[model samples]
Target: AQSVTQLDSQVPVFEEAPVELRCNYSSSVSVYLFWYVQYPNQGLQLLLKYLSGSTLVKGINGFEAEFNKSQTSFHLRKPSVHISDTAEYFCAVHYSGTYKYIFGTGTRLKVLA
Candidate 1:
């Protein structure tokens, strides 16, 4: 079975500082990954994704991730963050023929001032 792991349960970073949320996945076949953010009381929204092509991919709100095939990881990063960025971030993996995503436990990014 395929699985994803978010190493951190909570990542508290000061407002306007840099942050990185780790995501590691394991699969037997080819896989794609995605990063989704869910604000308080809201459903998850797509933050970024890794499908094919370049290792580095960018997304909305100044976020980006690099897919490392050898490491089987796709880690999201932001050079700076705002208080509004505080939310629960999830890492999901989709195998070649799967229709659904396998998500990690998620990491709550707390942007403190």
Candidate 2:
């Protein structure tokens, strides 16, 4: 059971305001998509990926996502958000002859500067 599900653990905005962080995945085969950002102690930072062909994917500070294969879902967006984009966002999955990495128990983006 390869899985990744992040349906908001926390999201409090104020600074520039505008956010959406929700992801869902359950893989049996093809998978390789990641969105990671953890600021407050720093480590993970690879803001976007969808691996295959385009289904609307963009990365880095601005952020963007839309890979919905019949609602398997991969949702993340940032319109107007700053405060250095207060961090802690993880949604990862890797399949297809694995190196094994499945996450998504985090989504704490509190940007209120």
Candidate 1 wrong stretches, greater than 4 Å: none
Off by over 4 Å in 2: 1-14, 17-31, 36-51, 55-77, 82-87, 104-108
**Per-prediction TM-score:** 0.96, 0.33
Span of ten consecutive residues with least summed lDDT in model 1:
24-33
* Model 1 error, position 108 (Å): 0.3
The local lDDT score (0 to 100) that residue 79 gets in candidate 1 is 99
Clashing residue pairs found in predicted model 2: none
lDDT of 1 at 27: 48
Clashing pairs for predicted structure model 1, backbone only: none
Cand. 1 Cα-lDDT: 0.94
Give the CA lDDT, 0 to 100, for residue 54 in model 2: 90
Candidate 2 local lDDT, 1-113, one digit each (tens):
77889988999988877898998998465787788998888799898999899998989888898888778778999899988888899998887798978888989999888
